[model samples]
Target chain A: MTLNLEPLWLTLKLASLTTFVLLVIGTPIAWWLSQTRSRMKQVVATLVALPLVLPPTVLGFYLLLLLGPAGPIGKLTEALGLGTLPFTFPGLVVGSVIYSLPFLVQPAHNAFEAIGSRPLEVAATLRASPLDRFFSVALPLALPGLLSGGILAFAHTVGEFGVILMIGGNIPGETKVLSIAIYDHVESLEWTQAHWLAGGMVLFAFLVVLSMNLLGQRMRQIGQD
Target chain B: MIELDVAFRLDRGNFTLDVAFTAPGLGITGLFGRSGCGKTSILRCVAGLERAAGHCRLDGETWQDDAKGIFLKTHRRPIGYVFQEASLFAHLSVRDNLKYGMRRVPASEHQIAFDEVVDLLGIRQHLERAPSGLSGGERQRVSIARALLTSPRLLLMDEPLSALDHASKQDILPYLERLHDTLRIPVLYVSHAPDEVARLADRIVLMRDGQVQAIGSATEILSRLDLPLAQDTEASALIEGRVQSHDDNYDLTRVAIPGGTLTVGRLDQATESRIRLRIHARDVSIAIRKPETSSILNVLPARIVEMQEIDRSHLLVKLCTAGEPHPPLLARITRYSRDRLKLEPGQEVFAQVKAVALMD
Candidate 1:
């Protein structure tokens, strides 16, 4: 039987979009967390990491309630001329971003924190403006951490199942991602299709984790050298 | 004229820094003190890197005035700082590191060109290499070159040579000496090494316990027998002079000091080149009568200026060559000799110097 590739495309799209958005928003948050001495830093960090420990369905449930017609975000979106996002692709993307946030932010935060204050201070004495220093010194040195964060976030988003189910249900091209598709195959007793998809996921997850370990090892070598 | 006037008070827990001093803008002004005495704090204040309650003015420009509530940030100030550890940007090549500051200044404001700075620092071969691969001395050279590329109005060096080994320090000393000879940028060098201060400083600010103990010309301050620098057993005086002539036959060189000429071992420098001679106190002996025959080759008529007791058995005497505008010299002798020769201030005597140390 010819397999429908719509779910795979949707999963890739969702993963790519979520990874991009998380990187854009997570970078500054991670940087702030790394540099701040304020008491509020731990509070903010805990909130970000809540997704890692909290059930994805719990986050998805809250997001579903918040994105429903009666909720504030839904009301605001409706007022802004956009309809409510309940079981749509946009709702799935929003759920994926929240679920995968900690994966992206923690690595970036650690990377930025690994760089102490000396490089920035040296840059300052050399007449580098604050923005210049961030772009030139901070970003280049923390590149490995940022890459790890992005890869983990992408992989985590692709493997997401419960969040998408709770927020988006399984609406074919609009919200049906790979994991939900695989679940649907197994529920219908399609054992062959389930095995094919499950095996693909296992291989993909293994490669991604291997690459992360390799990147970490390479960074450590560079640091020692 | 004074180029920098700094008065600051920084309170960081138990370590409090209260200092105020004025130093000339030309040549190197050394901030000499022991460790943790706030020498680096003063330098950080001058560089505008650290904010404390104080007033710092550079060449009549107010960098920070606590009374006026004005403090210029480090980037806005025209200053170049060399950190103790040679904190070069690891990501950038040597060329890019040097260009970081150069690009900040407009072309018209560039006093030293890139080629000139590279040649001066001898980092032309290291341009494309990353800082991680360079030796300690090479890294420091690049750091200095990077600071110079900024065309800074003031250069602040915080023990730039302290982190290196003796060989690396020796490797960088000539380049530093060349920098001193070529650049007009006023250098505020922080160092705990007395040799560095004596060799490079035009003026010295003696610091102890976060306070300015003394500030004056290098020769005047270093020769003060009352200060800790001169009170030590290794205390010596810096005598500025020029090479009068080099006698190849006797393998000796005669240096022209303010009062008279000094004959020393052979020197490689040509005649008329300036030289600094270090005269240790212990090498000098005072005699009431001039000795006609003695193994000592250098002896000059000197009048005692001041005599102070160094210890129970020994005395330190300040002497001036018996001539107009005489430079000061130190003679460390026994207290018994003082009573036997009836040595007193203003008494004409001969100072027999056994040996003079030439500073390379």
Candidate 2:
């Protein structure tokens, strides 16, 4: 089967960028979820998990509105003189982060929960301030959970299609990911290109998931036990 | 003097913990109660771990006062807390865990040194190992050492030995004894075992149903006939004794207690080491007259200071020996024995203490 490497590279780039961005933003949110007792915890938890249950196309549809030239997010970004984001690589990265929120949050929250408040309390008794405790105690204990969460989010984004299809659209070297490439090849009666792209994604997904599962298992074993 | 006058009402799903108490300023003041009795919660309240409803003040330093708007957070409060579980950071080595507290506590405020705590706990050997590899007793010792290194004004421990087995408890107990005897900082020890209280507590605050039942010296409260703990066959009088002499040939040791000289089974040790001795209540036997021939070596003439029924079967006799003003110790005998001897609270008799067991 004839192979097309451009779309495969784009998929890797998009998924990698998305996972990195989510980690930076998701860490504090996940920490808050584990530590907070406020009523807003439930509200925020439900909001973060919405992407897990809501149809990917539905999520993408609203995201399209929010990121379109005339929409709130798009208008604000344009005011800062950045060009339109719809159907661009950056657009897919944003969509990927939103769509994979739970993939990152649930693992991060679970890790934080497993660490418990006892260690943190001990840290405080040791004369550590809240910030110091979080950095010195919580972060090291939560490292495994964070790594697993990041891996899961990255793998999930690699396979993402419907969300990227609606919001990212098919722009070669921009938003034309592996799944889109395979779809486009089949539609143009190019069976060879379709099979090549599908094979690449399968192999990539297998390796990524295999390593993630191994890491997740290793992390779970290392935590608290 | 450290004064703790605090109140808190928390309703978990099935349990309720609301406590208030004040302890003596010096020595180890034990907060003792059975399981699920809010002992840990009270310690937490003192550490600022849980915010209670009332006021908490120590040595005139205010920790929390809802009415006056003074509520210091747990970190802000100068307290050292050791929990039931070691809860040491698993990622850090034993040395790092010890240092975790030292670096955060400014050099100006904390008087304790890293080397002092390491030596006190005898944790220098395990300094490089992660917390997970250490035994239960080892982890607890590290937990205690970590808290002490913080240099807090007061130390609070919540059933630190509960998770440990008998051997482990024994291993950690000496370290605790040293910490209590040598350190100037007072400790609030939460425990339910009367044995532990008798051994360690100078003052005991007995808790039942979330309230302080009685607050007094261990010797006084432990001798009571009604408290749940006072009913044990192991019921003993905790007497502070100084080693007077030891006769290796006679196989006997002499101890000078507050009231009089006590001759007990010989121990392989020299004089000058202070020992805590437990003379079990059931071990005592009173005679109207001084008996001539007996295996017992202790028979001091004691007057019946008080007598009370312990149960349907037994009578508790409080005896005052003929030396100065030491507090009286109790002896449990049958009502028949009490009636047959025509015993009264002030009746003078030779109080024959059966035997004395030396405790650390």
Candidate 3:
């Protein structure tokens, strides 16, 4: 049987979209977690990290309920003339973003925390307004951690299986990502196809982990210098 | 004028800082105190970095007024602050760090040019380099230059030299002296080093235990016998003088103080230029009569103003060389000498100087 690449293309698209969206939304959350002294900081941090420890199926089940037609978010979307999100590409994107959030946020949070408060205060004394300081000083200093976070988020999204299965289901072009396609091949006893996909995933995982280690070493060298 | 009347209390009541003083708007005003005496707290309050309950007015502009319920944030206040550490941005080059504040300031309010500050702090060669490549002294110079380029109305320095090594501190002091000589911005300098304050401060506000101990000219505060500074072993007296003439043959310069002139080691200053002399208490000796032939150079008639027992063995004697209004000279002599001369307040004697340090 000829191996179709539609599932691989779909998986790459979902992972890229999820990584982009997570970086945009996770940055401010990480910054707030690093800088705030409010009582709710721990609560917010725990909520962001919930996807890290919860079983993927459990998380996926809750996400399904929340995005289904009868749920609150589903109802709001319907009221706004947008259809409910379940077994759709958008639903898969949402699930992947939540599942991969901690991968992005933790590194970014640590990076922002490592900067301390002195540079920001110095910027303030130099008459840099709040937004100017954030963009000019804080962002540049935290770029390494953010890049690592984005990479981790993308890698983690690509490997996710249970959450995608629960929320996205098996739509060939829309939600049949690589992990689901590999599972389908194994269920039908298509050993050759499964081996090809599984071997590619192993190589991808190794490359991602190796690059993260290299990036971490580079970050440490920059810190020492 | 810079006016600060602030009261700050930390949580758990472990520390409280209450101080009120006004300093001239022209020269450096040193906040001299020991560590934990709240000098840095006062500077932070003036910069709007630390919130305190009081009012701060800088050159007629109100920075904070609690009674009026107005508190200006730090970025809104036109003040430059040099922290104890050289906190330059790690990601920006020296040029970009200097321009960080200069770019934010409007052109109409730009009083200090970028090139002028770069040359002032002597950081021209390092402009293209990153902060990490600089020595401690070079980094601090860039930090100062960065603050200056903002053209701030007030400059606040919180022990800017405290973090440097001895060699770095020496390297940076001349640059600081040049800044003082060339710039017109008022500075509030916080330092625990007495000699640093004595060399740089025109006026001083002494703090002890979170209270204002005294506020006066540096000369008065340094020489006051009752204050803690005079009782310390490093106590010295400051005297302003005009250069009279240089003795090329002896390699000596003659400086005319209030009532008498002193022949000191050769100086590079021109005739008629003002200079400051720092005469340590230990270097001064008292004599009942002037020695006719002696190797010592400076000897001037003075009357004993007051005497305080420094310890069981030493006595710190305050003397007036030019009478009232002129700063007094401190002589740390053995109690044996005081007894031998029968020294008493208002009695005439001679102060034989052993050394004089030139402070610019």
Candidate 4:
């Protein structure tokens, strides 16, 4: 049986885009969560982490409604001449980002937390502005955390099945991610095709996780030295 | 001269920091106090790192005025603060750490040269190494170099030697002295070590329970019998003098004080260089008359300025050299000696200094 490469390409694309978006959006939120003492910090943190435990379809159902024609985001997109997001590649990206939010944020938050406030204060005393301190001191110090978080988010997005199915459906090039394509092959008793894709995913995931652990160890060694 | 007027009140849980003082910004003005006495808080206030309900003016420039709603943030204030810990940027090399402050200010405002600071701190060898690779002393030296490169209007050092071991402290102290002697910017040094304060500070501001207990020249405050520091067993006086001459054969040095010369152990400093002598009260013995043939090296005619009973058994005597306006010296003698010699406040006597310890 000829293996369809479209799902693998789509999965990789979705994972890369989702990881990028998550990093861009999760950084400041994680920083704020780590630094803030306000009561609202807990509320926001819980909301971000809710995706980690909630069923993928439950979150996908809500996101689907939000991206539908009657939804506010859908209405805004229509007004902007971009049209609705359902069943689109962009919809898959958004759904994957939300589905993988905690994976990206928790590690980054822990990284920022472990840094404490002394370095920032030291930077301030050295005449660094707030933005300068964040980029120069905070960012470099929290790099290990950001790396781990980005990797986890990327891996999670590559394997995401339920959320993509509910939001973007199994459209071939648009949102037929690896997991969903695997499911289709299993249902059709295409064991050879299923074995190819499923085994590939397991190996890829194991390698990603092993490399993350190795990178973490290497980062710790560098930090200690 | 830079002048400072700091009045602040910060209510922390069980402790309330209420402090007000004014000092001329010159050679090191030591904020001498016990731990948790709000000394660091005051330094932090001057740096604009801590916001308190009061006003602070440095060199006539207003840094914080709660009533006027003027509070400059820490980065906006031109200050070089050296914390107790080195607090170096772990990610940056020593050279980058030094340059961090340099890049912030304009080139025209750079009063301290990068090379000069590195030389003064003796960190030229470690310029390319990361902070984590440095020893405690090296890290602090680099941190100090970084602060100096800022060319701050005021240098605030909060127990800069507190975190180091004895060897590291010894290693870093000369560089601190170099900064003290060369830098024109006023330094506010916070420390609880009396010797550290005495050796470095030109002035001392004593704090207790968040209150300014006393403020005066280091010599005056360290010698005052009425202050708690003077009541200690190691109570001594700080006498500023210059290296008069060196006797290399005998390893002896003659230091000229206000009215007389004191022969101390040989020092490595150049002739005419100003040095501070710490004459412990217990090491000095009051004589009724000048001795003719005695092994005691230093004996100068001193007039009794004041005498107080330290305890039932001991007498604390304050004396000044007979004809010069030098710092007063302290002599702790037994009450029996005071009574037998009939020592009075107006009497002229001789102070036989058994030993004079060199400070810096």
Best by TM-score: 3
The Cα error of candidate 2 at residue A167, in Å, is 1.8
What is the C-alpha lDDT profile of model 3 across B287-306, one tens digit per residue? 99898888888998898999
When only the first chain is scored, the TM-scores of the models are: 0.98, 0.94, 0.98, 0.97
lDDT string for model 4 (B137-164, tens) is 9999988889989999889999999999
Which residue window of length 10 is worst by lDDT in model 2 chain A? A216-225
User: Regarding TM-score, does 2 or 4 come out ahead?
Assistant: 4
Candidate 2 chain B least-lDDT 10 residues: B1-10
Which residues of candidate 4, in runs, are more than 4 Å off?
A222-225, B269-273, B304-316, B332-348
Q: Candidate 2, residues B263-286: lDDT per residue as tens digits?
A: 988875579888778788888999
DockQ of 1: 0.74
TM-score of chain B of 3: 0.96
- Please state the error at residue B226 of candidate 2 in Å: 3.9
Q: For each prediction, how big is the interface RMSD?
A: 1.0, 1.1, 0.7, 1.0
Clashing pairs in 1: none
- Give candidate 2's error at residue B64 in angstroms: 1.0
Model 2 spans with C-alpha error above 4 angstroms: B1-20, B266-275
Q: Which residues of candidate 3, in runs, are more than 4 Å off?
A: B1-12
Candidate 2 at residue A155, lDDT? 87
